[model samples]
Target: MKKTIQRPVVPPASVSTPVVSPIYPSVVYASDDPDGLDAQYEGGAAGYTYAREGHPNADLLARRIDALEGCSGGIVLGSGMAAVAAVLLGLCGAGDHVVGGNQLYGRSLRLMAEDLPRLGIATTLADPTDMAAVEAALRPETRLVLIEVVSNPTLRVADIEGIARLCRDRGVLLAVDNTFTTPLAVRPFALGADIVLHSVTKLLAGHSDVTLGWVAARDPDLAVRMRVFAVTTGMTPSPFDCWLAERGLATFALRFDAAQRNAAALADWLAGQAGVRRVLYPTRADHPDHNRAAALLGGQGCNMVSFEVAGGRKAANALARAADGVAFAPTLGDVGTTLSHAASSSHRALSPEARAAIGITEGFFRVSVGLEPLDALKTTFAAGLAAARDA
Candidate 1:
């Protein structure tokens, strides 16, 4: 396997991009070019013509993520779904097949189950942790193998490098949703992933205020196709959202560090509690993919910690309500700690059997650790646990 380091390209003098405004955290503008040129120069030819087709903010953000992912280039999308849809629709057409991870985001599962089929694309769901299962699920018509860097809700880290090798050998595209573990925690491209996607709404944005997404690839051709699909489908992020994500990127390294530390501490504490039926974190020795996660992801686990309560849905609901100061929100990755009942919030669309197969139980709750003081978060969890035990 060959690895390439991609450096950011400086836009030519004629392309005058905007300076991010200090007051508006989420908006930026491209000022008029000093040369009075309306287009970008790419070897004496125009590359970026319009905002929808291409914008300075989008390109800058893309380059930053490319650097983070160690990829050739990247495409920023309107949302995470747009990024996934662009990759799937751009890479595959009628009669093509897709092998997807069984434990995926609800919307992604819906896209695979309902939407892709409508376009004549067939899909097979497999346990990504099982290399043999993923390999066996591949077919001649399979155009892409889709997975998440870390499974949503479950927090199971996939064997990304192995899966990438499998895709390369099969002559298929490998795409990973790197939302849960942002590039700060894991670089999917370096792990052999052909394409890496992000729902900038989560850890990437750091704050819970923005909704944006991006897709990066080591292959220039793949990047071009995704850009074309994005422009044709009008799935570009607002200049405002792009600016917000960029601002978020500046603090990403710091925030993720603190959040992950808190998450690990919380996971360790939860494991010993009498009411905790299970604790799932990649760094945990008992995690199913602990070794693979350690080998591929290094020592830093993601900020998410998921666990099961002893009393099923009733206890889980009680725990959520019992937490003081922590917001019992369905979303994750904020400056303040947040919790969600996955069985009802993220996995609600799945059937009971499907949810069970994916390790999403009625007692499961996902906690996204934030930068809050560790003691405060621990106190909140302790209170929640005590309530759950009483329930």
Candidate 2:
């Protein structure tokens, strides 16, 4: 048969395969038989017709995520917030209510509190660490309750098992954001979470390169529904991004372990520093939720630390400026150490009173500890502390 301009020849299958999975960037896939393509579209046969609906890279990554999360199925989306939106919009309808932790990622809080309400989906925010607060916020109309395994900026660990039990008793679906404490540390599904969400842009991807997210469910029906919603709403992630994320995920355990070690050392160092007022790490004995974090996270502190400088915003800025080799990037889970000013970056959406109530003062800085050597990070932080003292 003569191949035309529209029809390209495909190479024959080889006996030997490449070690790395080949990236399939083609947006449209072709089949020789029209009936075959029709069957694929009809869901009777397995094939990729379009990138948005399904693709090799995404499917491969999703399967791996499902295995890791110990779930029946999972779906990958464009970004962390995209996964959040899918869960909210897919299962929820107008007049539905949602209860979320106040300590959730600022963007998540805004999405539920401000944006969803516009669609007649009311939201209630409460302390995730307190079971009473979580239960109190739930309404009969509440469809879902969302909380983070470990909150952003503040690093307060939630009672996943307790919250999960409460949600189950109330017949509300529970979604837990496991971004901070990845599956390497804690698996939310095992603790009874109905849906597990991840900002793969963080620890799962390990490197700060890709912006991706995923939602995993043990229920096949919920997983299928989420997949449909993601496809229809165009929350599709790039194939190249998925490829890159898979590459990063390969070394996640190593990177996460090293980062955790660095964080522990950094926390200990900061506690003894003159200008450091306080340090918040899950495993730290001084932390308020230390016992809960230890029980839930298996004594693994994960790779994040939030500390307060003695002075306020001015001191924090000076510390960030003087911190040698540490970038003041707002993002986390990088190969290199970086700092984020909570009030200015992560929690900027909240009002001054709201932020203050959460203990995100101007001097508060959250560190995404990386795979840097303990000694090296200590030196960099020492410089920052000195700057903070001088300021």
Candidate 3:
């Protein structure tokens, strides 16, 4: 027999807890007995019963996000659209009215203006910045007031506290899409919003990989109801996705800060470019709603920059082709700088009249500034703008 070297015994205190949470991917958890099963069915303080109802990973993500939004509780969903559908279907029905922003994401506009109407829910679209228009559009049957903190692509800012007051006076629910500005920037609950929505596919997840979203309710009763709606609708996020989202959220502070800084630099530089006609950035002094944004977002907007090319669609196309270092991706919130033609991508579903009404021109494009260095970004954009001007 070969002699084996004796190994030294490890110390008892050598082990430590993992910094990351483990993914619980079971569809159904084990039950100890009939009484245990009954307790779980009746909502006891036990483990998850079904993945559709909830899982350990999903619960962990939900609690973390809820704390971020200052919400009493929240639910995680498969995607942002699913979350939107759950909220609308859960809250409104036939004969109910929804007052919404005209400059909404194309899918959001389509859902509220088209799908909701077919379901017998009336929708009135108005400019969120125009408080008077918002108030005038409200009806006695209006049960929901939906708006984005900063309008997508255009970067227009709305007054959250003022809108909340408007909804409160009418006893309507105020649900804000806080995807653009994360919790680090502003807390909707602190501003009096009743429900807060976020598409984690964008800034919250901080990576393009996760396609999850969330709905946070400031009231615990609403939270419970929303969770039921989430479960019944079968829009729950997958275990793996929830785990990835949680990991993404851990580095959100670092990613968000760097991206926002890059965006600010790009917005400032683009404002002076000869090829650009108008730049829509909330934090800039020249922005139409700069004061409004300052009051709410503290002159620090998110990572979106929108501008119109001087030469219209032709110039915009040229810029897209000339952009050497950036990519023309359909989505946002990636780690690298990317360009997207808003009128063709996010707002493509809108008609010409509707698009024109919301200032999404043929030449307009939205840039999702990423973590690239300012000097390199400037060089890339300068080339693109030059091509646009010449084209």
Candidate 4:
């Protein structure tokens, strides 16, 4: 047999393990014991029975996220919205109430505002900026209170510590969306957040190629329920997406540093520009939530910036079209700098007056600053603003 063989049949496994976590795309896991499978499903044990219930990629990613978020356990969902749905459905049911702010990511607001009520889960949208408003909205049935660390579009910074304290005193679960501010800036867990959620589609994935979400909980029981809800909902994240997200996690420090530095520069420049009406950046002393943002975020702004262009929608559109070396991306946290109109994109579902109330005006736009050089970004943005002003 050895004489007849011309070459080695199987490639040898590396002596050292691969740096990247291997992608486990297996949908089903085989086990000889039927009872073992039942046990694995009944209690989230060590082995995986199925992808929907649990998979290696999702499990590994969840563990890493749990460590990052400083939580007891974690779960991954197919999309950010899936995570939102699972949190709402897993934690609350008929007759339960949720208190959230109006300044959340539009989809999150919509989910709490429009969808939860039909499911008999009552929701109250309050002003997260006002602790009094947030406290007043809480009801006897309130199960959870949700708020974003950095409110979408308007960039309003929430007082996570105050909100968490309020929720704790009331015996309500405090869930904060840590999408905009990764653990690098601040850990919600440190501030007493009961649950932390992230749309891994943005910064966690970094490349904008993966659409995934994560939820971390301080309570192991709640984590188990969320995992079960994820399985039942059939929103198991793809293994490939999980692997990519894991890869993105490695370079996050580099990417985030560049984007944050660039964003601060751009925000400062926009504030001085004649065509700019207002710059809503935490770094600026003039921002509505500057003090809160400073106290929480260590005197630095986030990777995102929102500003009002002089010409309203017409000029904003013109600026988007006229801008060079950038794109009008509807989403954020890409390696390349991109812009989006808050009115027509993130908050499009809301009525005009409702949008205005949240400071999402027609001229308002968001910039997810990328790894571009500060000087180069300023030149291109200055030209675009001038073009928008002329338009």
Candidate 5:
């Protein structure tokens, strides 16, 4: 009975391999040869000995992400913000400067504006869609330039190719957050971006059940550096979460296509509605970055839509209440359509003036379009708009 406690059930090795990736929940691994463990620790052998240093689940997911982004290597982190932190802290040290877009996600904005400053790293916020602004923000000490493929809620697309070129000429690393568009819409690495980041908890996972993120680098050395930082800081993701995200990723393409179709329909419907003050979709002709998005994304729109209502918070609340079955959650990228109020949700950390400076307002709402019946969603939006008008 005591011996049983020291040993667990073991399955016989079979010729057949698993169709799905098996989760390796072990915290420690044993090697037949004592020198084999030393070899792994010294990077002479290709194997994992500790969960914190490396794990099979993380390695597999990282490889899959690398393949999708067409990059040499990448690393998986515990959360989306962890990926961002790893890149900044690993690549840029004290006295280094980083240039980022002004329209970044709120938490990202805080990380740059507040967190990095504490570490002696300086950050410059610029409009990523404007080449002039990005180029002007670059300083001699600038080490990294970060931008989102698309501005959150506002749906403004950035000029990745142009920025990549500018960063290259200045010997600066360009990191593009590909969460909104994903690899399906655009591959930043192919466009010459040095680094690509993703909030896998969103679109990549396709479902909101797991929290995961990754940073892929065109340069293999940078990928290794990021992974080393993640491991050192104990930012590793759980094997079970990685397994869940991989499962979600398996159906990502199909789910994304269906959600995109519904989003386009919703955008069209909102454009014709009386209460809708504005509609923001990349593919829409009236969008500020319409032509650029068309050229970059090849005429395919993403699964996100944002629109402004006529009134302020009152109108937004009424609309949310009227929309039956759709949740008004702060997060996005679920199989079911959901709504998020920009001022109260994503940009809540910002002051009213700061939020207004970036186009976020009381009446602004972002929709995470999902795999739902187009007609049914339209009906819900129509009712919501009517309710807003009455409010």
Candidate 6:
């Protein structure tokens, strides 16, 4: 009070600034713009100008992801491939080259090998765990390096921080697909990734009901470019899809936590059983990248676990057919335990040689642990293992 008495009056503009919410409060649509202009073009509009550009639900989901990623901004896309395409197109042009992981999601590998080249972009696949291979694969025209936080079928954890350092020194953008680990286990941006992509159809959504994707960038400018690409390409999710994704996200942390615990237990039990050759859970000490996974993924790995059956594809098929509670499905990260044969399901798109090179064996069976009773899952797998041995 005494100080105020002696102080001179400050101008209204200089007094204080009002706080604005980081995320928009309510769902808005292109039609909601007062001027009736397209949502993206309305200069003074408080909400979305167009459905293709962005809606309130998408914006909110993006904001939530941005917060989880520790990034400046984010964009939601219609599918995981759309998010991947947006980043790749936004960052590189026709003459630029990309160095990507050899053991990536099958669709991503196909995109890099088949589609990007046709668009005049070149890509080289390298073992992300091999620093020498990565460094050697980097071309003078390389503008970006892409990798997965965890390999889909193999569960090999890439050295994200090491790769980030290499990219920073080379002045290249680092894009990481964080679909498997999700933000609950791994925050790729915080580990130095320039951009993080998520297939929200998986862990982020928790349930198998929704199909969505997102990309988050540490640099604000990059995010703007990605957003522009998304808008121009019309790779946007509907407002209803966004709402469903948001609902899925609300229980993601809880579901992932339980699923991961079940995965670890199953992995341990599987390792001790007959007819199981190898287990590929990141947290397991025998994993090649276990140390790196522990350092980056908060000690606890993800809900994905891959194992090798002793009898190759025949044994795998037998095991898949004999499994009791867990469904034999291609997709992952659902509430119910799911099993898939990588050689036939997720990696069917890859050439046999390419699949083998990435360690996707004929006997490989990938399991997505769910929030199921661990004891029951163990009993189910035990029975399947015995059946496979007999078969």
**Backbone N/Cα/C clashes per model:** 0, 0, 0, 0, 0, 2
lDDT of 6 by residue, 9-122 (tens): 333674666342223333333252335554337454454544676767788787887787777578889988899988888878899999999998888888889888999999
Ranking by TM-score: 2, 5, 4, 3, 6, 1
Descending-lDDT candidate ranking: 5, 2, 4, 3, 1, 6
TM-score of each: 0.89, 0.97, 0.94, 0.94, 0.97, 0.89
Please give, for residues 266-306, the per-residue lDDT of candidate 3 as tens digits.
Answer: 89899898978999877888999999888888767888898
- Each candidate: RMSD: 8.3, 1.6, 5.5, 3.7, 1.6, 9.2
C-alpha lDDT of all candidate models, in order: 0.85, 0.90, 0.86, 0.87, 0.90, 0.84
Query: Which residue pairs in candidate 1 collide?
Result: none
Off by over 4 Å in 1: 1-49
Q: What is the lDDT of residue 81 in candidate 3?
A: 81
Q: Candidate 4 residues 207-245, lDDT tens each?
A: 989999999888888888988888888988999999999
Better of 3 and 4 by lDDT: 4
- Model 6 residue 53 lDDT? 62
- Residue 109 CA error for candidate 1 (Å)? 0.7
Error of 3 at 296 (Å): 0.9
lDDT of 2 by residue, 103-200 (tens): 99999988987889999899999999999999999899999998999999899989889999999999999999999888889999999999999998
**Taking the tens digit of each residue's C-alpha lDDT, what string does model 1 give over 53-79?**
767677777777778877757888889
lDDT of 1: 0.85
Better of 4 and 6 by TM-score: 4
Worst 10 residues of 6 by lDDT: 21-30
Comparing 5 and 6 on TM-score, the stronger one? 5
Candidate 6: RMSD over Cα atoms?
Answer: 9.2
Q: 3 or 5: which has the higher lDDT?
A: 5
